[model samples]
Target: MELTVDERWDLIDKISKQTITFGRYSHTLKDAIAEITVKPLTGIPIAIAVMYGFWSFFGAFAGFFTDGFFVKIFDEHWLPWLQKVFPGEGGFLYYILVGDPTADNCFEAFGMLTSGLFVAIGVVLPAIIAFYLFLIIMEDSGYLPRLAVLIDTILHKIGLHGFAIVPIVLSLGCNVPAVTATRTLETKKQRFMMATLLAIFIPCGAQLGMMIEIIPGYVGFVMLYLLIGFFVTGFVLNKIIPGRSPEILMDVPPYRMPTVRNIGRKMWMRVKGFLFVAIPFVMLGVLLVNVLYWWGVIDWLADILEPVLSAWFGVPKETVGPLLAAFLRKDLAIAQLSAIEMTTYQLITSVVLINLYFPCVATFAMILKEGKEGGCKSAPIFLLGSLATLVATVFLFGGLLHLIWIILGVA
Candidate 1:
């Protein structure tokens, strides 16, 4: 009753500690999971293992949907029906819409309903579903934050804080929102660096899905190459860009069993986006590419960029079309790459380059907006410089990887 202020404050703190202890002890499962996931020694390895599982499942699931189901329907029903209705297979409109009916596969038959729909619905959509499902699970289960914690030291060495991992992970889903999310970063430098890294190296789920479909056994290698590029570019930018990386100060929420309703709602939002927004853009990309081809624009561009494409990148001149298409949509660009007949090395090289070159149109706009809002007056200059650096880095990295593969007798 006669206690001083300091004594009363001490008593209050003790009671608060007791309350917190009881609350924490009540969530035994959450604490147990955290003990493993947040420990320095085991955390990184576990995160890698989880990521590997995600990719493996994504590949298998997407493959089942694309090759087993969608391809069959497209080949057996959609293509034949379209050919019957629009009989002039060799006509200009038919060629533009349906591609070459005589082509062996839907991928080679570069038509809107044929190759485009097949890619968007069959290949990319399935991959998107798998990715979002996995991502949703991670988000619900609270593993993603632990992943950030696990990688925070490495990220800091490369000039990013742990919080940057949010955008990095989001970029895997889609770069536009990822770029928008850069607002969560504290400094202009961090945002710019993060955005640059994302645009350059993080292949969106759609693109990754297409890579999985097209390259089959080689998607992992491609991803590895891009990840290396990401770190290398980030390190270089950290040195070149003049700014201090802020420390990551974030709250790690409690782990809980994800409610089915919440998971379903989140999954539906992402799936709806893929079905409506992404698919239409993919079709538009296909149509635009075909129009450019018929108008001889693609040929002109290919000829103009032939030396760089063929000599520098080790890809054919036809790759210029897909490279250009990457600006519109990266997934569509990868789909277009499927039509080209090239060596595996060249295919890998092209995929690396596309991923490192630039973001899609939407992401590009978001980067600009974010830059301006963050008071970066020289946003365009920074972006151009970043693009130039990325181009050089990817070419060098791809060549080195190919050389190593050749030496190992894998190429």
Candidate 2:
């Protein structure tokens, strides 16, 4: 009953035509949204709006919780009680733990427990929670893919594809995870560039939170400067680093309502991880700075570095301690910097310097870990190369700001 191959195929085609029904399918709203969000013209504007909303929410939520609630608790109730109750009014332990006995607020206290706990729990934690919440919502709701597609071309200019945006955004929250996220990159070159640039350029959420709290007026300008440095440096690195900045085709999934349970779970897990890293480093920063200051090392270094700092960067030499603390945690360094007496412009410059000075301890270890996997470059070479690039960038960019300030009569 079986016919030859060609005859059987011809019979099947004839039968299929008669049996199968063809009909027009309607495009749903989800499909329409998917189309517009992936297209460049519509997607770019929407992406901008999304980011604007993200920032707005982050500021409002973090500010409300940090300023309206925690600031009061830390500054008024906790600090005064600690200052009064702790023994050894003029002794070392008192100074290290309770800070200035006469100081009225946590910001000026500059002690291991007072400022460290306040920055880690009160200020940075709120910002971390808010940032991760917004990010998770975007992820579960399916907007992240579109964002990746939207920015793919621009990112390619920096030797990264669209997916590279994951690490870039994550770096804003914490560089440790962000460095890990670089594994998703297709090549070692992209990983090295992304990790190194992020470590040097992008200030983490903790640092950003402190910036907002301490210098609300100047935060925007500082951020703009850093962002410009990020792209300009990225573009330059893309040119020199050997790699193929390949294009990516990402799927734009249909939008759906993100579940509250998933959002809460992810936010909690991230914040928990952050607390472990943030609290210890913040405490360590206070301990090291206090010990070094107690030992007069900071003073010696300040005296030695003064002429160069004053002449080149236009910041006070007192920033030497804060600069050292910046290696442990940038948020801690920024808090320390706020206690020092400085002009507004100097504060802005110092903040920028703290950002560009060095990556935190955790981030440094993470970079070292992820960097070794680079097939193109050895880990030691990567570390050395990154340090050299960082030194060059700090001098060039920091001095450029100093020069601009001089021109504007603000230096």
Per-model clash counts, in order, read 0, 0
Q: Which portions of model 2 show Cα errors greater than 4 Å? A: 1-24, 375-377
Reference-based TM-score of each model: 0.90, 0.92
- What is the alpha-carbon lDDT of model 1 when measured against the actual structure? 0.82
- By lDDT, the best candidate is 2
**Steric clash count of candidate 1:** 0
Model 2 TM-score is 0.92
lDDT of 1 by residue, 325-387 (tens): 888888889878878888887788788778877678888788777766755667677667667
Q: Candidate 2 has which clashing residue pairs, if any?
A: none
Q: For model 2, what is the alpha-carbon lDDT of residue 210?
A: 91
What does the lDDT come to for candidate 2? 0.88
Q: Give the TM-score of candidate 1.
A: 0.90
The runs of at least 3 residues in candidate 1 whose Cα sits more than 4 Å from the true structure, single-residue gaps closed, are: 1-27, 376-378, 398-411
- Cα lDDT, all candidates: 0.82, 0.88
lDDT of 1 at 9: 98
